[model samples]
Target: MAAESRSRILIIGVTGNLGFELAKASTAASHPTFGLVRDSAFSDPNKLQKIQNLSNHGVQIIKGSLQEEDGLIEALKQVDVVICAVASAQVLDQKLLISAIKRAGCIKRFFPSEFGGDPDRTRVSNLDHGFYSTKAEIRRLVEAEGIPYTYISCNFFASFLLPSLIQPGLQTLPRDKVNIFGDGNVKGVFVEESEVAAFTISAVDDPRTLNKVLYLRPPGNTLTMNEIVDIWEQKVGKHLVRNYISEEELLQKIHETPYPENMQMVFIYSVFVKGDQTYFDIASSNGVEGTQLYPLIKYTTVSEILGGML
Candidate 1:
């Protein structure tokens, strides 16, 4: 496809982790890329740096927020593809953006903020901190509005969860102990955020991915918690004590904890204990494996990620 003929992508939440990467990939793919960012994002030093990065990469900046429907509709009018990479807190907020997309009626494809497990398959209720339910709601709205959409079900983020050895809050690799959910053998698919972004951007212009879910399940990246710990152990040259959080115990934690913490526990149980990411057959569903779709893309594996951490 000619550069100018490529889909013009407008990524909401460009300052965010995945959103910025999507911007990078979109531009790299010769797509006329745009970013829908709030004016306030320029004030935060961290966000400003990202915004500056986007600007340097030739991403046309659209000064608009989802809250401002008028400005959002105007931004939507300028782009053919709208990808929302907003944080979990703002998943429901996409309803407004959806309304605006309907009003603008120019977007060829809409990628909602669902760069995680497929809510329809994962099956979580109230204890989930409203993460899956809210995303599922947005999907319904997208379909109801008859908006062309692609759902990126790129399960667990390796950078976020693997660094701490799957320990929820810890930011670094554990030295003495790590919590192993269940038998430490329930597998999950973990793709680094940037790779997820790249695969997502690749699907923007794909007809097969239109109104279908793109599952980022690289066979090499599919791993269990025990396998991850084994990799860390080999890197550190020492074995860490395994603190097993059984399914029963995990459910107890989810029920006992409060708000966000409770929500975290719910995810731990869902991903690790229940094995939601790998338990389903993507081929049977309305989805295609990202690696299968784009085998040429060099996806980072868990070992490569852990090796770099050291």
Candidate 2:
């Protein structure tokens, strides 16, 4: 495919971890990619580095804010697809972005910032933060406005959890004790960040994915927490202490922990305990399994990703 013929993609939150991967994948796929950056990114050292890296990759940077209607509309005019990769804290804030998309009236597809669990299925609304509710609201707005969109439900990030062996707040792979949420048998789909970006970019122009949730539950990547622990044990040639956090204990943690951390606990409960990701069937009316959509795209399994870390 020629660069000029490909869709012009504009990513709203390009400085984030997943956002950067999306930008790289878009450019790699020869799409004329654009990044909507804020004025403050130029001042922040880390973000400035990422901006420089993105510019080097041929992503045309359009300096604008989601809050600024005129600037956002101008940016929207230049792209066919708009993908928002903002953090969970900024999910609801995308309401403003959706309104801007409507006003611009040119965006062919809008990928809202929902790269985790499916918000509609996950019942975490009563928690301190409105993570699920906010995402659900954004989905409603996108549908109500009749914006052609794709919701990427990539579930757990392999890079985030696999690094620490699913142990919260630990950077290194645990050598001794590990917290096994529930019986550790509940399954979840874990995808590498780059793989998520690759599959997401592949579906950008795919008609099958339009207005449907792209569930990234690759067969090799789906596994129980206990199965993940067994993989690590095989790699280390030793068994670690498995401290089980019972369902009741996890509920207490959700109630006791503070914001953000508590939010993480809520997600843990939803995926690990409630079996939300694997429990539902993807009806043809709502979703298309990503691996099945593009069988040629090889995804790195959990074991392979963990082995690379060591």
Candidate 3:
């Protein structure tokens, strides 16, 4: 195993939120970084701008896709590591990626698109959730192919969960009220996106993380929903009306929700309200302390995130 700086890194789905940040971090580390984008992504103004930004930062843009085997294999042949940051909806498509990686035979490390909770420890009943199930499938595929890989169980992304719990695009606390799933007592790990990216890049060639599930549970970032709300209240100096959605009600919604976005909400309810995300103890013998690996990186806490939003 070699340091990530010495490895040629290719990040798939570089136009995405996590992928974009990862490409930036990889380039910052002076790794020869390449970003994989679909040929069509260049046509859209927003995606094109993101691609251009990565290009400006010295990321070589490779125009190909997981679906296009020949082009993907050719793109992968130049890299030692491949990090897939594809969206949840696109998780199943990684099968094509796995095939390409095997065909390329040059990739020494492969990171699948799992930057959330530990799917291995998730209960079988909840495994059917598209988000977790697809991730599980990809993990199995990666293992079956014997690809040297790292699986990151980053819990929740603070940027996503904070705004998502209330409303998308609303970066502040709810004005008058907020929904509290269950009793808000269940604790879950939350990691900042940039920190996750930094850790992933650092772990790219770290032997300890190879073929291991890297859990991103920095002590400061692990808190229950109640604690998060209290911190928010303290930061804004206002008590929001707490509307509690019981476990029973959320389970019913999980069963009944038809819309994809609402179904995603149901999945969130499954994770937070039902306590599915915190099933594993990261401090236990099974977990790897992420902060211990890179002591210099000051991981962001909920309060810091809230303060920045204010």
lDDT of 3 by residue, 1-310 (tens): 3444489999999999999999999988888999999989999999999999999999999988888999989999889999999998899999998999998899999999999877776653452446677788898899999999888888789877675443323555676778778888877667889899999988887888888878887877777778888888887788888888887876676567655546556545656666666765665625576788888878988778877877
Instruction: Looking at model 3, report the run of 10 residues with the lowest lDDT sum.
Output: 163-172
Tens-digit lDDT track of model 2 for 185-284 = 9998899888899999999999999989999999888999999999988888889999999999989877878877766677778888999888889874
- Predicted candidate 1 versus true structure: per-residue lDDT over 172-234, tens digit per residue: 889889889999888888898889988998899899899999999888788888998998899
How does candidate 3 score on lDDT? Answer: 0.81
TM-score of each: 0.96, 0.96, 0.90
Q: Better model by TM-score, 1 or 3?
A: 1
Off by over 4 Å in 3: 1-5, 124-129, 164-172, 283-287
TM-score for candidate 1, residues paired by index: 0.96
Candidate 2, poorest ten consecutive residues by summed lDDT: 122-131
The local distance difference test score of model 2 is 0.89
Whole-model lDDT per candidate: 0.88, 0.89, 0.81
Q: Roughly what TM-score does model 2 have, to 2 decimal places?
A: 0.96
lDDT of 1: 0.88
When 2 and 3 are scored with TM-score, the better candidate is: 2
